[model samples]
Target: MRKQLLGLAAVAALLTACGDTCDENKMVSGGFDNFPAPSASADGPTPGSAADFQKNVQDTVHFGFDRHDLTAEAKTALENQAEWLKKWGGVNLLIEGHCDERGTVEYNLALGEKRAHAAKHFLMSQGIDTSRLETVSYGKERPIDAGHTEEAHAKNRRDVSVVR
Candidate 1:
């Protein structure tokens, strides 16, 4: 019984030593001192960044049901987007077309593609370079509003401009 008690005490001592050594090594090698403090910017997002574009200009346009045509409101949004793109010549854009969840997947994909092209063409006409704009269709897969309502559907049928 005494021999068993001594064995347990030795094991406890070894475990205590190992715990302290591990902690010390962790403090010396993986400490927060190795990381630099983050610098904060007061002027807001950097120019030509995605945040800047979204902040300074409208980046989305809603479409009517089953329509790929650009409404006057959509045209206005695209105009603003084109101006921002022109100002930030180095920034490229990805135009994502999303659809409401009423149609078949194949049909929605085609419609979404048309919607994307509609936005892209409008931007191109407003003097944004075609080379800087790419288009993609999300069909009914990525709705902004998941609820089954007209208002939600309207919000889901949209073209969003993303900085690339």
Candidate 2:
């Protein structure tokens, strides 16, 4: 009986020693959107593989309606791209500019060219070689998102950096 009691005490002590360390752990329960948010990272993943480049470095920088100027957010993304280019020196990129379906072909094509130039100039300012970069204006010919909604239009107005 004494041995059994001592074993019970030891078991209790062991359990107490393994007390909960998850006091700060939390689980959020809510209605989730169908689309998951992009995972935020400090420096993002390394820029060696194609998958890593797509995941970590943002390939596209969005612009406002009928605008070729880069936003602060676009600048930040381009800075990251510049860093990636410097890290992976062998990469030659094509900056493809696109636009929404609202404008005429000629106007949209001009806007797209301006957008591509804007992105290329920014990358060049960040020390990326102009020789390593090429620009193409898809205008409204190609779009990643096809919906006729504002969100889709926003996505359409972008300069995509493609590995060549």
Candidate 3:
């Protein structure tokens, strides 16, 4: 298992070298569409195998319509992520709040901020240091799926985390 994980990490590193953001910790997806959101990749201690390391970290979790409450599923996801974070100390992360393309821009921005803060609070409750987290809101300015459909709107509502 270790060997296989190492091989995957090697592959990820090679892929990242091709034109991705390579942080000292791990390879972060460079020039990604949603740059502020929890990138689709992890940036953390590589732990001898990138795959093993990234497997511990996860992409950001999405929210529901006009709601900032972290769903039960989201709670589980954050708990898992917190576990991964505890594995690597002396780290900082950014929480980017987001929202769907509904409501006024200003209102959405406030909503997004609340969502991001909520995630940060949850992570804190899980034992992550508050000093390690910062919250920002993008509102509806950034969207992972940009169609005028419910599916796209749903995907846009999210709280993403980035290791710094």
Best by TM-score: 1
Against the hidden reference, what TM-scores do the models get? 0.76, 0.70, 0.68
TM-score of 2: 0.70
* Ranked candidates, highest lDDT first: 1, 2, 3
Per-residue C-alpha lDDT of model 3 across residues 1-164, encoded as one tens digit per residue = 99999999999888878774646566455775635343233564345233443556665798999899999988988887788778877666788999988899999999999999999999999999999889999999999998989999989999887766
TM-score winner, 1 or 3? 1
Candidate 1 structure quality by residue, lDDT tens digits, 73-126: 999999999888888899999999999999899999999999999999999999
Q: What is the lDDT of candidate 1?
A: 0.91
Cα-based lDDT at residue 90, candidate 2: 92
Error of 3 at 52 (Å): 6.6
Q: Over the stretch 1-164, how does candidate 2's per-residue lDDT look in tens digits? A: 99999999999997787678534346355576533435422455434655567887899999999999999999999999999989989988899999998889999999999999999999999999999999999999998899999999998999999877
The candidate scoring highest on lDDT is 1
State candidate 1's TM-score.
Answer: 0.76
When 1 and 3 are scored with lDDT, the better candidate is 1
Q: Considering TM-score, which of the candidate structures 1 and 2 is the better prediction for this target?
A: 1
Native-to-model Cα distance after best TM-score fit, residue 2 in candidate 3, in Å: 56
